[model samples]
Target: MCYIYSRLFMFFSLLLLSFSVYLIILDFVYIIEYIFIIFNSVNITYIILIDWMSMMFMSFVLFISSMVIYYSEEYMNGDLNKNRFILMVIMFVISMMLMIISPNLISILLGWDGLGLVSYCLVIYYQNIKSFSAGMLTALSNRVGDVALLMSIAWMMNYGSWNFMFYLDIMKNDWIMELISYLVVLAAMTKSAQIPFSSWLPAAMAAPTPVSSLVHSSTLVTAGVYLLIRFNYAFSSSLMNFLLFISSMTMFMSGLGANFENDLKKIIALSTLSQLGLMMSILSLGAYKLAFFHLLIHALFKALLFMCAGSIIHSLSNCQDIRCMGGLVKQLPLTCTYFNICNWSLCGIPFMSGFYSKDLIVEFMSMNILNIYIYFIFYISIGLTVAYSFRLTYYSLSGDFNFISMNLLKENNIMLLGMSGLIFIVIISGSVFNWLMFDTLIFICLPILMKFMTLLVIMLGMLFGYELSKFNLVYNLLSKNFYSFFFSSMWNIPILSTLGVNYIPVKMGALLMIFDRGWFEFYGGQNLSLLLKKFTLLQLLSLNHLKIYFLMLLIWIIYLLVQI
Candidate 1:
């Protein structure tokens, strides 16, 4: 039965993959046609290749989506909802395609909303309480971002007309362009999990591994970086300064948060936020190609890391807390091996994919002496990444293997295969994908040397982490939830006024205490009554009917007065 189901899943996945490729081909054909029309002095309503950035973005979506579809087949192995998962994954790819190929704001919005909706469904696929809550948080947070984007679109339509090609035409209007650029950056920061709006991503770790793989690595989060690059031409100098400041701040804070996290997934989650901040900073400097290059490399290594972590957790019967894991190298050799490779790449080790991309970003910023401060932040972030990566690696793969309860190590062939493939991709990305972007000598050499220096910091930090583990000082800080404490304190004003009071009432009253206690029946009855009121047609009619009757009576009285 399993074999039959696997075969069916493979068949459907291949079909969708083929369709996505065909769509890419179709988009290229249109691009070529539009280009030909432009050169021939023909009347072209839509601008194709408005800039090389657009073309690069389209190519990125095509390449990443292709990789995602291929990877999903192996990741979703043996799941009953395999078909449904594939469907959403394909829809996500298609929406991304639409976003890059969109000639107008309306088309782009359709793609944006489409991706958002499908992502919500994918996040909640586990259907548990935690998954549902995470999904809700993701939905709410993204909706706020989406509203900003929608407002920008509406503003453009009113002032600049509905034509998407207006961006190219209105490039000279500095003030209006800057205003629009700020609005777009606001949306991008929210979507990319930058500071002040980053809580959703750590919560989103409740999602399944493949979903996390997709969100962090390739699809949803990439959209924000893509947006910044796409609108690079429209931004003014002041806007760029603002972006650089915010991006740098986000990088520093998120790295600090990652350093204090105990959960392996949340560490990666925070790291992703930091990496996106780096990419945004690059984009702020108008280095679109470099930003996109870093985005591509980060996606490959981060996904590999996440999947490797997932494989370890699965083998240990879903143990995610790094404190519980100790010395798993021998038992899970493949996972440990891949995790080490991915960690090195993530920390920007010399000759690795991350080193090449990250060095380029640093060199791009190094053009100004003041930008060295930004480089300092990047250096600090690199050290922290190495520390956490090695901490995770050492705790899970190098220490004594006494804490784990599970003895039978069931190897997940499909998961391992998927992870191995990503590891292979990361290994070769510097050589193979290097041709995709331009790199200077400084870009090439600086990151390689820095990687070694960063490695030393990692070694020292790991020793510190190990010693602290023995004392268990940091473990308590990690488990007591460092990030959550900061978040609660930051949002304490509203919580104190509303949520705190609500909880206080429950804590004080006997009836409310019973409801808050394990006796769910007390609230269950009230909930049922509310549900009945919501669903009953008579209640709906009374609500709408009363309003309509009032309107009719007002109109009758007006008619009588007019007749008199």
Candidate 2:
């Protein structure tokens, strides 16, 4: 069953890939616009904007989803309901496609809602307590974005249409439109799991790895980036400037969290969050095209990275804690190779897929005279990325074997087949994207110091990670102090997001329950039932005699005769 679905997705991906190639060759933007008139002066229009960007993004989504589907066959081989998993993944891909091609807010909302709901379904597929909690968090957090989108749609009604693309130019100067922009930004932030909403992302890792690979890495999270890209024109206001600060903080926070995290999947989840922050921050800087560039490139390697992690987990008896993983290179040589390639690419190693975009993003930021705070945050986050990568590598791959001796760690052929397809993309996607997106490549002139700053900080981070891993200095220091628990637990974001986001509302609900069960139930329902029962008992016991009925009838008759 899984094979059939996987192959079907692969076939569809191929079709989309071929269509993308044809569109690229023609170098033409095609718009198929249709309007359905329901009544007088009332119509819902459908705009299918087929441009190079949309086609390319759609192709990538389908391709990665296909690979993920194929990978899940082996990874989820033992599951009784793998077919359901495939169906959910397929539904997710369809939603992402709907999002990619639409310029209309209504269509975007449909797609956006689909993504959120499908993701929640996937997250809770395990049917366990952990999965249920994670699913709730994921669903509610994304519901914020859904509500924001709905509000934006309502606000757009002021213009008598939900075609936001048409209004992007006119809406820029209008304060009312500014409200819509703010709503959109908030929506994007939640979809992308920025800051407070970020707790759902790591918690979502309770899902199967194949889901984490496709949804978290490439499709669902990037929906926010795509939204910003579509609405880039509306973001030239103070709201966007404020968004830049928030995004910067989010980026820094996620990177810092990744450095302290020990769970292998959660660390990767944090990295995804940090990269999202980078994309959001860049978009806030009005570098929307550059942000899109990073989005695409990040998707490629990140998906591959997650699959590699999945493969590792599969071989290691499903243990995801890096503390219990080491010397995997010797056991699963092929998987380790893929893991290292993806990991290095993630750290933005030169010439890899990540480098082309990440380096350019940094240089672009450096070229602009920004506030010192933004500058520091950008560089420090980059350094932190490298630091965590180093720490993860050291703990999981380089150290002595932490797994049980009897554990078998052979590479699964089916999983490798799926990974091999992604490896090709991860290698050439950066260069291909650079050529396609930029007609004339962007060249930024930076001071020599600034030019080398990214590499220098990365190197410093590597040193820091290696030393910290070898000496146990950071662990010891943190364990002994207040900062240790805070950093390790991602500043208690998971606790605060779950307990904080839900606590007050849940408490209020409990109070409401008490009111309903105690006062309302007793007085409104139980008392009424008791009073009826007593009345029925009195009628049966006291009024059952025929003499009573006859006496009442005679009194009624005498009163009627006197009135006559």
Candidate 3:
């Protein structure tokens, strides 16, 4: 059943990819509307915007989803709930498609909320405490974005239509539009797992690997980036700068967190957060096209990365600790190859898919005259990205095998087959995407030293990663040491966003409950009931007094008539 569905989605992916190519070749944009409502002479339509961008995005999304479903055939083999998992994945893909094609905010919100709800379902699919907690975190965090989208919808209602595409140009000068832009950014930040919202992405690792690969790596998290891309025209300069700052911090935070993270899936999740920050930061710089370009490229490598990690985990009987894995290059060579390719690609190794996007971002930023803080954050984030990449590599790929000696680590061909579909693209998509996305050369002028700075930083990060990996003093690490615990705990964001955010409100609620049950209850309801009970005679008289009065009035009227 999963196989059939996987093949069907693959067919759809190929068809869309071909169509996207045609659209790109022609530089065409197609918009069609289905007017479903007529009120006060206004035509409210459900709008579908089909252009190169939507088509391309839809193709990539379908491609990754198909691969994930196909891989699950083997990865989820013998699991009773495999069919249900595949179904949920298909529903997720449909939701992403709905989001991709729709120009109307209402339809987008439906798709947005759909992704959140289905993801929560998928996250808790394992039916365990950890999975349930992760699901709750994911659902609650995502609810913030859903609420933001709802607010955007409500605010845009004043325009008489939910189709925000038409109003982008005019919104630039309007205060309401500026407010909408902030709401949209807030929505984007939550969905992308930016600062204050970063913990959930890692926690979502409690989900199955396929879910991690498809949802966290590519689809669910990127929804915010796609939304911003669609609504790019409405951002004011102030909002853009604010977004820039937030995304930079998020980028740095996630990169730092990834280095300290030991769980295989979680490290990748943090990397996803970092990449999302890059996308958002570049988008804020008004290079939305570049952002979208990076987005597609990142999806390819990261999805493959997660798939590769899933293969490893599935083979290892669900073991996810990096410390427990080492020298896997000897046993699972192909999977390791795939993993390394994706990892260094993520590090922006030259000529790889990640290289095109990341290098371009750094160089593009260098050309701009930004403040020193932005430059510092941007470069440090890049270096931290490389540091974590190397750290992951040193721990898992190069060391002596640390797992149990009696284990069999054979490769699963079906999983590889699914991954193979993406590996080819991961290698060549850098050059291919660069060509397709840019019609002309992006002329970046920088000095020789500046050009080498990226490479220099990457090398430095690699050295730092190696040193961290070799440092035998285990007690000095982030989660252990008091000083570095801040970085290890993601600046204590998980603590803050969860316990910190909830503590006061929850305490207030407890106090309120005490007041309600103890005092307010007695004062409002119980006391009133007691007073009524005390006056039982008057209560009974009150109940019958109306009938008695009516009878007396009738008697009086009869007497009066007789007298007259």
Candidate 4:
């Protein structure tokens, strides 16, 4: 079942990948529209937009899913529910495809809801307490976006159609339309795991590694960024600027969190969160294509990174802690090679797929007349990204062997085969995509020092990474302090988002439950029923009094008759 599914998906992925290239070459868009529903003058339509952008996204999603399933076949070989896992993956991809191909708000909502539902299922795939908690976090966090999308859909009714693509140009001028844009942005923020919504991304790592690769790389997290990209026309300058700040903060937070994170999958998940912030930041600068560019490249390397991580965990008997892993570059050279390359790309090392996107994004941001604070935050975030990447490399791939010496680690054949498919693309896809997507290069004139600043920060970050990863008395002492706690916990975002976002609502729900179960139950149920019972008793007593009066009258009449 796994073999057939994986092979069929691979063939379709390749076919779609090539066809997206074809669509780009031809510069064609094919829209299929059906009148889903109509009322009076409104013609509600179900629309499928086939263009290079959508096609490219579809191909990337399929390619990654194909690889993930192939990897999972080996990774999940012992599991009884491997087929179910594979099917869930297929459902995830289909949900994503529905979002990617549809321009209609309603269709997007259908897809959007599907993503939230299916992701919840995937996250809780493991039958454990942690999985259950993680899945709830994932579901509820995304439910915010679902509500936002639904609101946007409701707001679009004023525009006379659910096909939002046709009305983007007018959304900025009309106040109501501006409201819609804000709603969409809110939805995007939650979906992409921005700020308060960011906690779910790492928590979602409770799922299997293959699902992690797919979710982190393309389907779930990217859904928000893609939505914002499609709705780029609707954003006012203010909303864009707001998104810029939120995304930058998210980038900084996640990068810092990853440096202190020990769990290998969670660290990768945090890094994915960090990259998403970069993507959102670029999009806010009106570089939707560039954001999309970053998104695709990220999807490629991130998937490979997860697959390699899966292989590592599989070899290590399902161990996920980087602290317990070290010097694996020698024992598992091929897997580590893939891991390092993906990490380097993630770090935006030159000639890497990530370099093409990050370098361009940074340069583009530099050219703009932005506030110094935004600039500082952006560059600092970039530096932090490098720092964490190096820190992760230091712990996971280098240093002395930290694991049990008896364990013999070897790569799985199917895992290697799956990973190999994405390796070539991760290396070369950036240049190819940059060439195809941007026909004419963007001209940027920045000073040399600023141009070199990115590299400088990279070096500094690497040095800091070394210092940070070093184990010593002072380091150990500091590790016990508040700073470590703050950074490691993603500024306590998970706690705040879960307890914080839920604090008021959960309290309100409890309050409401009190009303429902305590006051309401008393008044609406028990008390009312008790009062009715008393009223029935009173009526029965009145009848008894009448019967006694009648009996007394009958006795008096009998006595009078006997006296006569």
Estimate the TM-score of every prediction.
0.74, 0.89, 0.90, 0.89
Predicted candidate 4 versus true structure: per-residue lDDT over 71-189, tens digit per residue: 88888999998889889899999999999998988888778888999999999999899999999999988888888888878878887678888889955699988898899999999
Give me candidate 3's TM-score against the actual structure.
0.90
Cα lDDT, all candidates: 0.69, 0.86, 0.88, 0.88
Report how far off residue 226 is in candidate 4 (Å): 0.4
Residues forming the 10-long window of minimal summed lDDT in candidate 3? 472-481
> In candidate 3, which residue ranges exceed 4 Å CA deviation?
37-44, 474-479, 519-564
Between 1 and 2, whose TM-score is larger? Answer: 2
Per-residue accuracy of model 2 over 114-173 as CA lDDT, tens digit each: 999999999999999999999999999999999999998888888967778788987689
**Could you tell me which 10 consecutive residues in candidate 4 have the lowest summed lDDT?**
470-479
Q: Count the backbone clashes (under 3 Å) in each candidate.
A: 0, 0, 0, 0
Cα deviation in Å at residue 333, candidate 4?
A: 0.6
Superior candidate under TM-score, 1 versus 4: 4
Expressed as tens digits, the lDDT of each residue in 472-497 for candidate 3 is 46634435777567886889889887
**All models, RMSD in angstroms:** 14.9, 12.8, 14.5, 12.4
Model 1: which ten-residue window has the lowest total lDDT? 488-497
Residue pairs that clash (backbone atoms under 3 angstroms), model 4 = none
